[model samples]
Target: MTPTDLPVLTIDGDRVDDLESFTREFSTFLDDHTWRGNLDAFNDILRGGFGTPEGGFVLRWVNSDRSRQTLGWDATIRWYEENLKVCHPDNRADVRARLDRARKHEGTTLFDWLVDIIRIHGPGGRESEDRVHLDLR
Candidate 1:
């Protein structure tokens, strides 16, 4: 299935009032042209939980500028390992596990991480466009 075809998991938040707005913006951000090309790869990363589950989120780009020029999952994984260093400082174990799974191309570690984050932070929790390191904690 395609990235667009994948379902978006709902997450809870501190203020239920912000949920609607967050969902709208989050959907827009993911739907942006720059993101569409690599939506699958981003989904792959999201499925792995490189981003935080609460407060903010992240997207891995093959290029530093985050332009969706590449068309491969390996590039997404490489982007995470080479450039993006997400995960809370205390969550190093989680990060390392994700790294290892990504390296081995395992699905559980990656998708569970993604589901957990989305469940914890909801959509608005994703990182801001200008943020380099998304710290949800």
Candidate 2:
């Protein structure tokens, strides 16, 4: 099938400052029109059947540069902090180390995490069978 035939979901990056904001926007892709999932949940959504067509969809991100900066190191640290609070005790140390890395500007930013998730569902990715495509405009 041609690219135009598949479903497409677009989120304006300029409007998202952090993971919460991104989730709020990403909820537009869910069947219930609301978000209650974490990063893993976001990945599941990409697998389709959750409002997204099982056949797959195109994810369009506009003004992504601004988003990359906004969700950079500081956002990464915040993400880890939130997880640290409710994470399983055994995982706390790992989360703490990640947070420390973010503080040192040494690990993935929220934007990177998001793009990685999306790409995983794209061409040549592990789930490339889904036919999900990334449109970073």
Candidate 3:
């Protein structure tokens, strides 16, 4: 299936505090599938949840910086690994390239990359709501 065919799951990062809550909320948000205590199941859910697996899906985490800190670096890495495993083989290379870009650029931190994964995989493109903007008052 084409990238545009993939579903988009937009997460409000402000609400995710820990893995448990994140998982709970995520599952609730999808409202069709449940985690089966395995990365593979998690992967399946990531691909489409109750939706079609062939098309996969995009997970956009808003306020990613805060979410990254909340999830921690190790968790983030684990997430990346799991995400890669679930990605279609044909798309893996492109995903890896995105990861590399995030690693190489000082401005595009790991947190940024985590969020970008969603945009790269789907037709949502980029939106202001996807990012966390800080305003000094």
Candidate 4:
């Protein structure tokens, strides 16, 4: 189907500064947007069937410039720290490594991570059939 035929589901970056607010923005589309509050859950949600359409759709993130700044390093560091606190014992080392890298600003920021996750369901990604395009504005 043409891109125009698909629905446009928007998330205001102005409403998303971290994972908490990030998931909360979904209330605009879902009756209960309360979520697992993690990257894995975010990825799963993009797969559709919750409240989002099962077919192709556009996830337009408006005010994305502001979101990039808000969901950047600071949010990444905080997420990693939280993961370290609750992640499986065997995963502690990896979480620590990521936290260290985040502290050093040596890897992808949280914003990049979110974009990557959403894009993975788009045209050429691993789950391309889902056709969940991310329109970052």
- TM-score for each predicted model, relative to the true structure: 0.27, 0.92, 0.43, 0.91
Better of 1 and 3 by TM-score: 3
For residues 88-134, could you state the per-residue lDDT of candidate 2 as single tens digits? 99999999998999999996888998899989998879999888998
List runs of model 4 lying over 4 Å from the truth.
Answer: 31-33
> Candidates sorted by lDDT, descending order?
2, 4, 3, 1
Task: Identify the candidate with maximal lDDT.
Answer: 2
Using TM-score as the measure, the top candidate is 2
Candidate 1 weakest ten by summed lDDT? 62-71
Per-residue error (Å), model 3, residue 82: 19
Candidate 4 has what TM-score?
0.91
Candidate 2: stretches off by over 4 Å: none
Q: What is the C-alpha lDDT of each candidate?
A: 0.37, 0.85, 0.51, 0.84
lDDT tens digits by residue: candidate 4, 9-79: 99998888777887778655654465656778878878876778868788889999999999888989998
The superposed Cα distance between candidate 2 and the true structure at residue 48, in angstroms, equals: 0.7
Which is the winner by TM-score between candidate 3 and candidate 4?
4
Model 1 segments more than 4 A misplaced: 1-72, 82-84, 108-137
Worst 10 residues of 2 by lDDT: 28-37
Give candidate 3 regions above 4 Å deviation: 1-6, 29-31, 52-54, 73-137
How many backbone overlaps does candidate 1 show? Answer: 9
Please list all clashing residue pairs in model 4, or write none if there are none. Answer: none
